[model samples]
Target: MTNGFCSDDFAPVKEAFDRNFKELGEVGASVCLTVDGDTKVDLWGGIADPKTGDLWEEDTASIVFSCTKAATALCAHILIDRGALDPAQRVAHYWPEFAKNGKENTTVQMMLNHESAVPAFRDPVRPGGFLDWDYMVARIEDEDAWWEPGTRNGYHMVNFGWTVGELVRRVSGRSLGQFFADEVAGPTGADFWIGVPDNFAKPLAPILPYAAKPGDELSEFSATLLAEPQSLQALSFLNHGGWNMNDPAAHRAEIGGAGGIANARGQVAWYTALATNDGRLVSPEYLATMTRVSVATSRDATLLVPSRFASGFMKSMDNRAHRQGNQASAIIGDSAFGHVGAGGSIGFADPECGLAFSYTMNQMGQGILLNERGQSLIDAAYKVLGFANNRSGAWCR
Candidate 1:
């Protein structure tokens, strides 16, 4: 049974949340939805640790992987809104070291929108070395541009934390984590963290990796990508010092693009702030720049599929974001924007509907984007919002 409140208007959302555990093999998860600044549904259930049989408590939080990127982007946007940083300025204007190796022309907007062509490291990064921020920044500084600046676009993956994060640090005179906490999380009272602190660390749930069954067969697309050790797809993910969600050292470090630890409540709250144009956080004009489609295409050099992105956020464009035969953007309403974690966790805001929703889980799913587990919950949410018949499946717009 789910363990949180669900208002009468969102009863259908609770039904779908329960179905995730019964039918989708959900180990533990939470779904939170806030509309017009008030929470409509907040629920969490199942075992947080199967080994110890620990219940997933109301306070439990976990690593939301790429979902962290949206929060990181917010830090930059906050600076932009404050007139402390300019998006069109070259990144080299803030960090001269970045000007080397044909990247002198790369703009802050290009980096924010994933069009800067910064992907993987030329030299192999050591395991756990991702915790060393200075070393990682040095590596990024010396690396050559993977593609001509602003010409081709690829997901920055592990590099985004340093590429854009360092720029935030230089311009703001604060680490990305400090800037986010001081400006976004603290002011808004959201339980999200780019760098997990000592007090919050205990509530962090460990992630369990998904393993394919013996009968599963790799798609030709998947087989070919894995077969090449040097493919851009392979390099972008594998080149990172291997990731371990439970590593305390890693959690304590602020890897802005990913490595964010948060719960469904925190995720929903952050987006609600965005949806309402909480002027204290983001101005409406700049928020438009954030939500507008900055890049839209079918094939990402790193992801090998159609991907849509705004400035530091994912746009719900087409089915190219599908995962495990499910529309990853299924929950996406027209013009709605948010980011999903590496696993099934998702968080997005629909301005037109004044809706902010988030789903987070410890059980990793095979889907690269939205899994069946997340999609089902999304479908139910939109149904209650009176958009059940929307063509985008779960979209409310």
Candidate 2:
């Protein structure tokens, strides 16, 4: 069921990957890891489409949902590193229209840190509005801030693509997708795409939604999504203009917050540059700023769970004991920074250990964060690196 290579020292990761298929119901997935800028594990297996029984190949790409945020954030940071954008500056300094509706004080950092107070649309989005970049940008510009911009934080969820992505477009004079292609993916040779092109030849894996058992409980965020359709939790995730996530059109649309398409190898390759500080992406100083925790809260407005975020990326967040239904946690090295997708997909750079790790799968998992299948692999990697435990919410030596 599994195929690929694993370094001798990282054999445990391969075992964990296999166990995901045997025990955790992983459908189609790929996991890749790099340490000290060396490829340590690259594996993929299972059926790409259960309906057709097609096999997952070496280059099969799947929608990696919110993991795209890391790529989007990296593009913005590149512009920041080049003096083309400033994080601390008011966002209106670049996109003048964003200042309207109590957002005059919204800084670029606020947008990246999820403190922009525009986490979701209060009104319903028009059909297919998410696919229209201009339409979404205009909507965000015209919408009122939910609260004072800098007072607190909420997971921006889907709107993150447009909010920070617009800044990338305005300041860099290029669309977010193009900027990522030209600057990040192209230079690093990562086979990830913000907007998949028509000629994309690799086999695409269709996502299989998670199925809940009879006794499965709902997370607080899930309960809110069900009970309060107008709440930020629901609006952020459910107000997406009724776009079919698995459709080809959605793949072509550049929804940077949740529409990235890639395999595990592509994510690991991209993160390797950052993990090694290889000078291809950003300076070490800027990388430090990007990885440092920017905001943390016991209860996220959207997710309704403990959360920690860096600028445009997620830090190690252990919510195992914080809730009853979904005890999901993204427990990586303390210094690691990355984003978890809507399901189980994850990608991160642990600079402390010179490791870049990623796991991508077509089968959606039951949680807003890393599920057991993905976390098990992470645990194995950390153990091989001699990390003691994730006792303090993050793995440490």
RMSD of each: 1.9, 1.0
lDDT of each: 0.82, 0.91
Candidate 1 residue 362 Cα shift, in angstroms, is: 0.6
Worst 10 residues of 1 by lDDT: 320-329
Model 2 lDDT, residue 215, Cα = 86
How many pairs collide in each candidate, listed in order? Answer: 1, 0
Candidate 2: residue 206 lDDT (0-100): 94
Q: 88-168 in candidate 1: lDDT tens per residue?
A: 999988999989888889999999878777688767888877888898888888888889988878888878888889988
**Pairs of residues clashing in candidate 2:** none
Kindly state the number of residue pairs that clash in model 1.
1
- For all predicted structures, in order, the TM-scores are 0.95, 0.98
Give residue 139's error in model 1 in angstroms: 1.2
